[model samples]
Target: MSNPTVTAAQANKTPVLVAICLAAIILPLSFVSGSIATPVISRELGGSAQALSWITNAFMLSFGCFLMAAGALADEIGRKKVFIIGVSLFALFSGLIGFSSSLIWIDLMRAAQGVAAAAALAGGSASLAQEFEGRAQMRAFSMLGTSFGVGLAFGPFLAGLLIAHFGWRAVFLSSMVIALLSLSVAVTRLNESKNPNAAGIDWPGTVLFTAMLALLTWGLMEIPSKGTTSVEVLGLLGATVVLLILFVAVERKVRHPMLDLSLFRYARFIGVQALPLSTAFAFVVLLVLLPMQFIGITGMNEEQAGLMMMALSLPMLIIPMFAALLTHWISAGLVCTLGLVISAIGLGWLSQAIASQDMFAALAPMALIGIGIGLPWGLMDGLSISVVPKERAGMATGIFSTTRVAGEGIALAIVGAMLAGFVGQGIQQLSLAKDSHTASLAVQRLATGDLHQALLELPSTNALQLTAIYASAFQHLLLWLAAITLISAAIVFAALCLKTVPTEVSETLCEPDQ
Candidate 1:
């Protein structure tokens, strides 16, 4: 016999789920869409390379720094209130970004948009956890994952279409429209949810965490251009270390910590948390690097490159639905481990194929990577939230989300350094055969990632040889990326191997002090 109370709750869940999914879609959409439009923005505004990088870095820095505090606030105040505020602010800032006359204004607005995203993401995930439980919780998280995948998969395609027809501003304008629509749905359908007995915010812990993230991210962003040994880079790294130590000390003493330190005791939780970092390092970094390869190595236009990426993105959209089903038969931990292994294999294959310089040969590896990445996409959020209490959903999701953003930033910096090092070495070797000035100029064009420009600057006879040199350097970089990804998989697998004492989700959600 069906219970009327259970039936009523199920019926109300649908609208709330829709609103949460929309919120999930909006944040990633804003991120990837901006990435696609960045070149056009730089061209139109006449911004320097350093200033242009800030357009994206500013958003990432603030977004990552604010996530922990925002999540705690959602648990303390109300998810509905935070979600609505985030959506509204996101819309306002996104629209303002489109109207900016200078690069500085755009960077400032993008930073504001990041803060708004942290709020919406934390609040939305917590709300969904509060509204559903058990199998229903798994389904809700799967749908949320699907929405996130869709945003990332189609973001480039949509941005290319809009920028080609309506100009780059249209990309931000479109985001504004989506945010507004999500805001309206949220206001109408979402219910206020928070921990009734939640303690006050841990201001000291929050400040220390935010400062540590900001300094760390700023230093990472600067490393590619300034090199690792620069005074500014060393200073930021030193400051970040001090803040991280301070943050740990404060969290231990705080009555209500921004991040509960005891959560790390569970090996299962640690394994689940590592998924975002692995995915970001392996997949998100590729998303940034591959477009450059397509344009610089293959001489593909922006539209063509965006379309080609569909080979990678399409599988991510399709595979997650099956991941849920697979987990029913296979343990979620084993499923995640398999996904990581497959991703490493795919990346390894791609490194070999980069030397071939055949577009068709690249597609198969790209598709394999997409499938491998997608398998874990559906499982990560569900598993992370399941281990913790519903009340702590915001904190868990905040930490998960932070790893992703920070991982991407760190991966880019690491890969950038490798690429620069290898390419410089390749150019130096090539200069022994040709005039040093011409070789250096050709390599400089290659570094810009503009194939057409490199081709135009070099003699036809030399173009093919110079391209081969660049391609060889790129292949080496891919090998390093693949190695790092494989290492991450091994770490996750080892973590999951540890024996863990099972506890009820409800029991886990109780106050840390209790």
Candidate 2:
């Protein structure tokens, strides 16, 4: 078999590079479709707040769990072959989601879609890195970053429009179109990157890793709904810990580990991983909390809030190209770290915003946050793969992709818990302040449904008191977000400040088989 080669004159492979970027773009874009549909689905299915979040978590848990295995498979099989299979499954299941009438069906479909997405995403990034070296990789990566930002940015607005005009079902319908286009381009232009001589798949490592991630993600998702003491959540967490420990032991013994734990030996590799994980943690929290705050506290409709929040997405498109250019002259670590700090500032600013604050004022902070997303989104993988041998690109990309999804899942659970706690404390304070007769009624209204309805029924005599309490509660929640964002910023700084050397070399440093 002859290898497909690029010549000096036939070097116009921008289409292939764009297609690779598009493949990555499609994975996250489809993820947003379900994420933004949660609130709308809740209305349709009489779903609980807990259920709204599970829709996102269900997808993330599956995607994160199987990512490492997907990467390993890409190396064992072939990148192009795995890419096509993943996208076909993704598109098929994504369309089925639109027709789902019940919550259980939707959750099941979402999980399957996640499994398929992990394959496409893992292979897509590895193929891109393998196909384009040095300057070309940088440019293609920068574009990919912009697309990543764009997909997330567009998701809310798309969902909002579909919900307002056609209903939530339209969100899934749109995914079918995007998935088809992505699948078509991938099938036509993408080439394989597998080495036939690479060792067979690490079946033991794959099973253990998937189990560890799934259990942990499930535990995290359950925490806000079941409370920290719930027997089920505790048992899941315990099992996850045990499985994770077992996974580490197994990986050490496997000849060709799915994750290649040895990559941590390189400081650059560690930094690259941290850049995305921390940024994703902070970023996803902002994505989830802001719309909730705007809708719940500010009396804005979902569409209005989603559109206004597009500020976060706009910067994602602009900043990554600059990051690519910066890497041409400066350390990639420094560039990524700077992006994280800027994003932290944005999240801090967001946490400080008051209810009904002007959109422009909020956008000021969001601009910095968008830039932060751009930096890491644009450069982290390029930097990480640059340091590793070509053969290990699939595994490296998989690990990074897994971490990214896991970080988002963890943020969702933790932040959801924080928000519920804040609201619960406020309810307690509100109830305690009322007369004994009114206390029961107040608690009932708050618990029944429709927080606004509960607020409206408060006697005029107690109106001011209840309003003050709600205001205090909202402020406390914002403060908590600010603190978390600041902590994430600190971590990004610490990771980026470490020394690292960058090179445009081939499959040499940190070989996969080592």
Candidate 3:
């Protein structure tokens, strides 16, 4: 016999799930779309490299910093309320981005969109968790992961089409339309839920933590240009440490904490945290680096490079769904471990193929890397809160989301800086550049894929010479990344596979083979 209450709950879940996925598309869409449209934006508005950088950096900064606070707010307030408002604000800011005549105005709007993205993610994910449980919950989060992958998979193509036909403004306006459509669907069907015990925001913790993230991210960004030891970089990083200590001390003493510090005790939780960090090293960094290598070194145009990336991102859309099924046969921990191993293999393969500068030879390795990344992406979110009591789902999502997003920013910065150093060293060995200063300037321009300008910085060098330097330097970088990814996999195994867990986590992580 079917219960009416259960039937109604089941019906409600589908609409809410669709809405969240639709809203999820806006963040990554904005990023890739903006990247494809940057030249168009710059021509009309006029921006120096630093000013243009704020187009994405501002968004990431606000988004990463506010994730935990927004999560706490959703739990303290109502998840449904937060979701609706956040998506609505996202639509509004995205639309505003289209109307801006100045780069600064667009930067401000993008920053606001980031805050909205953080809220929408935290609230929507927690709400989704509340709508389902156990295997059903795992499936729902898999769909969430799929939506994110779908965005990355097609973002460049979609943005290119929109920018070519209707101009760059169409990209943001189209995202706004999706957000509005998502809100309309969710408002009627979504249920309101929150933690009864959740209290007001922890003012001290919120401020300190946000400032800490802002400083840390901004400091990392400074490293590529300013060097690690610059006063600006050193000061910001020093302040970040002080803020972190203060946030921890405040959260411990607060009666109603913004974050529950005790959840860190679980080994599964630690493993879940490591998952995003691993992906950042193995996959996220490549998203940017590959485009540069293809366009700047391999002599592909933007469109061709974007098309080549499809081999890397396309599997993300389906492999995550497959991973969910694989976990039913093996422990999720083992699944992630194997995924990292696969990516390490792909990285090594790519290093070898990349030297040939043949796009076709790179396809298989790129797709392999995508499949490897998708495995953990599919399960990490479900595993995040599953290890904790249901009551703390909001906090769990916040912590995990913050770690994932912030870790990406850090990886990009550190890897970018390291690559510049390697390229500089390679150019010096070539003995074509006039001096160290000329080599440094060439490295800076080449790092950003401004090959024409980079060539200008080295008058004695031809395209072949500069790209050869990059190919050799890039090969070494890929090998280093492969080694790091394998190490991260071992760390993940030590945390999740080495220890025995309770029944809830056991179901989440492990299943006996048939």
On lDDT, the leading prediction is: 3
lDDT of 2 by residue, 1-514 (tens): 5335645412556666666666666666666656556655766785555555667777777888777777778877988787788878888887898888988888889889888988877677667767787766766666676677778878777777777788888888777777788777777778778967768778888788777777777776665446678899999999988998988999898777777887776555675677666765557666765565455545566688668668777677667777767765666656666676677666667645543355457777766777777777776666667556666665676777778887777666766665555545666654553554344344333322234544654554344444445445545665665555566556545544543434533322222212
- Give lDDT: candidate 1, residue 46: 56
Residue clash pairs of candidate 2:
none
TM-score of 1: 0.88
How displaced is residue 430 in candidate 1, in Å?
3.6
Model 3 lDDT per residue over 1-514, tens place: 9889987877768888899999887777777666666655755786554565567667777888788888888988999999998999999998999877889999899889989998998889879878888777777777777789988888777876786678879989999999999999889988899989777788888898888888887787766556777899899999999999998999899897877899887777888889998898888777767866765567665566668888888888888888778876888888988999999999999988877766689899999999898888887877787766776666787788888887776777667777877777787787867876676667776665556667888888888877777777777888889998999898888877775655545445654333
lDDT preference between candidates 1 and 2, better one? 1
Q: Estimate each model's TM-score.
A: 0.88, 0.84, 0.90
The candidate that wins on TM-score is: 3
Candidate 3 vs. true structure, TM-score: 0.90
Candidate 2, TM-score vs. the true structure?
0.84
Against the true structure, candidate 2 has what lDDT? 0.67
Tens-digit lDDT track of model 1 for 1-514? 9889988988887888887788788777777776666666755785544565666667777877787778778878998998888888989998999888888899899989999998988888878878899878878887888898888888777877887788889889888888888887888888898888778788998888878877887786665456678899899999999999989998898787878878787666677778888887678767767766775567665667777777878787888887777865666666677787888888888877888777778888888888988888877776676666666655676677777765666666556556756765776765532564554444545653544455555654456776676778778887776777788777766665444535645322111212
